[model samples]
Target: MAAEAQSEGGLVFHPLDQFKIYSLFGENPIQWYTPTNVTLWMALAVFCIVGLFVFGTRGRSVIPTRVQSVAELADGFIYKMVEDVAGCEGVKYFPYIFTVFLFILFSNFLGLIPGSFTPTSHIAVTAILGFGVFICVTVLGFVLNGAHFLGLFWMKDAPLVLRPIIAVIELISYFVRPVSHSIRLAGNIMAGHAVIKVFAAFAPMILISGIGIVVTPVSVLAITAIYGLEVLVAFIQAYVFTILTCVYLKDALHPAH
Candidate 1:
């Protein structure tokens, strides 16, 4: 397939070829327990997290190491975010929120590798994360607030006549949260990576003398810029997902309004 793309004089780019799933070993067929690219990257992400928090910070020294400092900073950051967003009550769930943040953050950054597969770019993975949050918060909301959790759908501040209409809208939006949350992360990461792929594909193809100079340079610049942007985006998307989870947890904890 790659050879075919290069055969013609025209430059053909398969931007999405990066996202295709393949077994780590010989391609027999993917089974329920098959080790694919997605599984490998995700496992790598998990190992990285463990290395940072466990081995990295194993020494409880007064003078911290770089790894320890980073671990401390991340913990403090997410702790503060939860406390601020969900109030003092939300602090209890810090570990869960922090885990989610680290997993997504690590996955996003790891996917930036030259030939790495992004697990978060796939809907199957993100959907699990998204719906997992959805289910947890939904169940927690009902468990904590009981019938008051349903009050989340009803706006008491709105007009008497508009309450029912607003409730319906809120109900729909509430259900749509998982879909939007998962898609938002997957879509942004996938789009950014695909754009970079397109630029990269053009960078090495010197088809014509005159156009190659301009095209190659421009493609290189675009790839560089987009790659840098994607790094920032990786962090931002992780932050966004974590903050949204906190917001949902806040709603679950206090479903009054």
Candidate 2:
């Protein structure tokens, strides 16, 4: 139900909901929805990550080539991020954290490609990821801190009479984490795509009109600039999600803090 906009160059840019892509199946005409495009792109993202890592490290060498060097750089970056955010104890969770980071980063980048759907743009995908982090953080808190983790919701610093009120607010905030986390990523990607589509729709019309020669160059530059910005956004969003996960894990590990 998103609206389409006409840019200065006369291109009609429509904001299509990629999540609506579905499949029909079964007797009685049951609609079995399959996020085919989303699933395929997500799978591709995973494949790319695995392929790069495997191929990059196939032959261990003291003198690394460009690909190997890039792989090592990524590994060190994630390792340091995990260590800094969740501390040395977080090393055990490195695999999960790294996987989540790469998955999101790749998905965001993939969406920028023409005709590719961004799985992360859908609420369902983002919600699932957020829920996974929520569950892990909750379980980790109990496992690491025991019943004392409940203290995170109840402020012992508050006066005894005010403790219940503070606990209620804290509990609400804790439950809202998944909602906020998922929506932030989804909304940002959705907005960026919508904007890019609108700009792209205009480029052709501008080129077709002889008087609009100036508009053609401007539109081209705009598209190029936006593409670069999208790349930056993709990485930032991934880092934000990872760091937030680490922060949640930290709270679980040191509940009193």
Candidate 3:
């Protein structure tokens, strides 16, 4: 009966609430802050990026070590993505795109650690990332294309009768970018983690039941496979975010195209 109850409970899905503010300053307004696991993950993400780049580049060797080779591969991957999406003209923006991708990727992967929180799973983090891309694209659009970029929203070149309708739709889409971008990342990470947690919560139960012993290996294997999948997802999401930024940059450079 206990085994049955445990098995049943294992099927119950519950989300772990990991968000919390860790500090408040009574004496110093500037020091008042929300402490969260998210913040730690973000810090770690930044550290990993800096460490990898520094370590990877330090040797400057003709024949690279495995670590250096891996780093160079990552660098080249982002560079090629920028070139593909934004064109050769887009190479100049590679730095920002690369940083954004690596930060988000590392942060997402870090959350897969047993106790670490995923910053990208928080709306605040995703929103900031999305907003940064939005602002950069908007600013670059005007700077590079001048008044011509206004056509992106105004539909000035549209047929005289269709201009107003087209502009309205374009305007709506423009405003939706940040919200959609942020939500997509947050939703994906949150869902992935939730699923993994659900599976993990089942592992022990399956091990404890006499019947569960039969299923224990299967449950363990499932967890292992899903974890691997989540790792892949981390990279894919980062690539998607970075590539989208490149696409936006291209729009900024040539809105009409």
Candidate 4:
């Protein structure tokens, strides 16, 4: 819960409280089996994806419905992205990439709803996604290329003396991919939501104090602007995450420079 303090002006703000996770059940210590807001939102994202692909387009028709059209567009979009970024071999992995895209896309859009939770705003959720992709690509690279997979970090183009230094830097960066990947998504989502919440808090200023007249209108305008930007950011972040995954897959499939 958001901590609140009373003052002479009766104004307060705790924007970060919206991201807190709490069990659906009574107040108790969380466990693996506990159902939290994160679980609810993640499940909702999955259901939305299934609904769009399965039920939304269950009936194949010559003249498609709006939902079917959207479904097709999304499918084609991801397919082309995979093929273009990772090449034809990566097409075989399109389903995995598409699934990740849908989950993140849906979660981001859904989180924009009032009073709803954003699973992507949490590091735990994003870390799982980032690390899962990292692990998958690493294993696939080795399975497909054997010891040659190490080529991903080796810099043969550099001069003999600089090769080892470049390789060491590349090796560290390779391991850091998951950390950077996960934090990028979580940090952006959290920052946007927190900023929105801060503006929302000021929205009530008009009713609380005399200085609120100016604060309220500015806050509302800021909130509106930020909200619009956030809508775009929601899609861009998903696209970035998915495309990066494709890039990683491309590296795995062809580890050679």
Residue-level lDDT of model 4, residues 1-257, one tens digit each, is 23334455565677898999999889998999899888899899889988988998988877988999999999999999999999999999999999899989999999999899999999998999999999999999999999999988887787999888898999999999999999999999999999999898889888988889999999999999999999999999999999999999999999997
Query: Please, what is the TM-score per model?
Result: 0.95, 0.85, 0.83, 0.95
**Sort by lDDT, top down from the best:** 1, 4, 2, 3
Which has the greatest lDDT?
1
Misplaced by over 4 Å in model 2 are 1-11, 17-35, 159-161, 207-216
The TM-score that candidate 2 achieves is 0.85
- Stretches of model 4 off by over 4 angstroms after superposition: 1-5
Off by over 4 Å in 3: 1-13, 19-36, 154-160, 207-218
- Residue 110's lDDT within candidate 2 is 83
Model 3 per-residue lDDT at 58? 83
Q: lDDT by residue for model 1 over 1-257, one digit each (tens)? A: 66687676466688898999999999879997999998899999999999999998999888999999999999999999999999999999999999899999999999999999999999998999999999999999999999999999888899999999999999999999999999999999999999999888888766645678888989999999999999999999999999999999999999886
Kindly state the number of residue pairs that clash in model 2: 1
What is the C-alpha lDDT profile of model 3 across 36-146, one tens digit per residue?
Answer: 445557778888877778876789898997878888999999999899889999999888888889888898888888766888888888999999999989999998889
Query: What is the total number of backbone clashes in candidate 3?
Result: 1
Q: 3 or 4, which is superior by lDDT? A: 4
> Model 3 TM-score?
0.83
Name the better of 1 and 3 by lDDT: 1
The lDDT values for all models are: 0.93, 0.81, 0.80, 0.92
RMSD of each predicted structure: 1.8, 3.6, 4.3, 1.7
